[model samples]
Target: MDTYQTMDVAVVGGGPAGLSAAVTLARSLRSVAVVDAGEPRNAPAEGAHNVLGQDGIAPRDLLAAGRREAQEYGALFHDDRAVTARRHDGGFELVLAGGTVVHARRLLLATGLVDELPDVPGVRELWGSSVLHCAYCHGWEVRGRRIGVLGTSPMSVHQAMMFRQLSEHVTLFVHTMPDPDDDAWERLAGLGVEVVDGLVRMLRTDRGVLRTVVLADGHEFPVDAVTVTPRFVARSDLFEQLGGTLTAYPMGAFVATGPMGRTDLPGVWAAGNTSDLAAMVAAAEGAGVAAATAVNADLVAEDADTAMRARAERYAVA
Candidate 1:
């Protein structure tokens, strides 16, 4: 490990959000460091969407580009996970998995969420490729094909509707979801969506391509693509012990934060999926920018306050 060092801000996570924040802070002449575990949430997807000027770009490419850009602006990066963090000396101290420790005046938590998939077999094997979570992210590529929306909860209703817009043939599999009321049925009927009520036994794939969905009752429905609603669990254990609180949402649990990623804990901020479970790549990057701006402003205010206090002390001595 390197000698003890202090930085202006320490960013945990290296996805679009964290990298964006690091670039912003570094370009602003602030000493920023990003510690990434290298396990991105979208690593399995072929490419990312809704990102301007780089639509259809692979997630790895985008992250590499972001790292290069941030590094050019003098941002430091650590390729290890942050195991623990604690408040120290009016700032924060983070210990990495490799026993490296970092001190920073401010902290930005960009750690994203973990997607807990359904317990059905082959779903995990096909995730991010044939089995998707976001319609907007993978809709166009899989559009105009037979699509299946696996029901995990009532939220699956929205997934079905979104996919229905892309594909003419759509099926909502009530794998474990309760039966919807007449209004919900009417909506599904209006959208020309067929409802299949049965527990999914497994996803059937051939040569890594999704082919069909197998049911427990020996029925099989052919599908070109499939979508599922995953449980989003935040990666916030490192900071949660440091007075940060995780809030519950219908989708999952996330760190509670105010404007510009300000959390209830002082000297600590959170952004990206750590705070917003539903934020896409582009939205997460925008959040990173916003958080960086706010952190810079906070630092400026603190610097001014310290300078004024020193001046007052010197005047009193004179």
Candidate 2:
């Protein structure tokens, strides 16, 4: 590996967005480096669905391929976690966990989201397989399967309604939540969803395939799918340290960004789930492409101004 004095782009996180940005910048003839912590929140996920042509690829396999593709394009992959980021003279300086320093002209935060699932047993096992999160992502594959929409709040009422579009045999499990409003109740009944008011004990499954949900009342309900809106915590603490304000989301807080992932702070950009709470892997990659292009343009403008000033200085010296 060539010892890089400075990188044109420094992408944090090795997930889809970071890899996509690094690859694009490298192809554009820029030195790029990706800092990844080697842990994805979706590690337990059996496969990444909803990715066109690459559906059903395991999470690790998908990331491995991304890393390989980016590396092939001369993008350096740093297997260390970036702990601190401060604005430098030209761009930003990052301090990794082990005191490694990397200087970059631009930054991309692609650190993905972490889903805080329910405290119920077997959730980790069933998650990303029979137990799912996004309806648009995993709904089609689980169509016609008996599904349960576990309620963490009144929002589960809407989730149950959405899943009804996929299957008529959907059940809404109201785990420890109070009764829904009249309108919420009406929506469920109108959708023909079965509402259960018992705490979920365990989501019994087999080998990544789901079987049924066992409730605390000792009632085992046969369910082929379990949909719960797992809580989320943003993966981008680096952005927060840079004074980027986060907006509150129903699931979690995420870095606020412009259309192309440019944050309020200059020289620092964010894409993927770190900023886009609802973006899929494909969408995250697209966002990264857009952000990288914008960052490159910004840097080019900066370099042009610097060159013009130097020209004036030379003319005066003459």
Candidate 3:
């Protein structure tokens, strides 16, 4: 099996967070390795929004640029998935699916998350295009269009209000979400949002283009775009292997971390969507940089301690 030399840091998932962390660590003169399976959560999206100076850039293109930047900084890239993890020699060892092993003194998880979209037909097929979530992510592109919000949870009402800000033709299909309270009804009315109460059978499409939302009762609502609230489940398989538990919330679950992305596990940290489910691209990049700085500081402290110990031993021998 191929094995890499012990590195200062090993980052899993080469998305925005992982690549950003690798760049920061390499710039600090640390030997960093990034392992990626090449499966990005946002790959299906047409463009990444709200990215400063690079707005609306294709997701794959953004990642390619990031990879080049990290490589230029002397960070190593492993185009493989980490399948297993364990403690080794007071550090961490990760076994990749490609039969490669990596050892690092510190581990940073930027594994992002998985969006479990609603089970309704066409929802998954149209995800990142006609079907959407996160108003800030794609709301602008869909402004002034026929927007429909699929109610899967209580948060659906809130989703409607957010889209209403961008367009006047907003409709909330209370498919499977809980019944809205009186206040919610009043709020919807005040905002001129239409509420449809029925089970959504499917999202009808033409040549992969979303056309309408079909209800179980045979009623169809024409919509240019449909929004949903997906359960954001963090990609924490390696974290779990390292004996870390995920923190659950109403929206989904994620890895719990303290300041600078420090997790409960020693010598291990989490950044980006792994720790913050709602983190956008810019926020994920920031988290990665923060975690890298913290990891570098930790290594510095350890090196200083080792140097002091060696000095004491030499003096005693003299």
Query: Using alpha carbons, what is the TM-score of model 3?
Result: 0.99
When summed lDDT is taken over every stretch of 10 residues in candidate 3, the lowest stretch is 37-46
Note the Cα lDDT for every prediction shown.
Answer: 0.92, 0.84, 0.96
Q: The CA-based lDDT of model 1 is what? A: 0.92
Alpha-carbon deviation at 70 in model 3, angstroms: 0.8
Best by lDDT: 3
> Which residues of candidate 2, in runs, are more than 4 Å off?
1-4, 205-210
Worst 10 residues of 2 by lDDT: 1-10
Q: Cα lDDT for residue 168, model 1?
A: 88
How much is the lDDT of residue 35 in candidate 2? Answer: 93
Please give, for residues 216-280, the per-residue lDDT of candidate 2 as tens digits: 98999988888888777778688888877678877788888889888889888898888887888
Of 1 and 2, the candidate ahead on TM-score is 1
Q: Per-residue alpha-carbon lDDT of model 1 for 1-318, expressed as tens digits?
A: 753578999999999899999999999999999999999999999999988999999999999999999999999999999998998888989999899999999999999999999999988999999999898899999899999999998889888999998988999999998777789989999999999998999999889888999999989999988899999988989767797668987779999888699988888888899999999999899989999999999999999999999999999999
For model 3, name the residue pairs that clash.
Answer: none
Residue 307 error, candidate 1, Å: 0.6
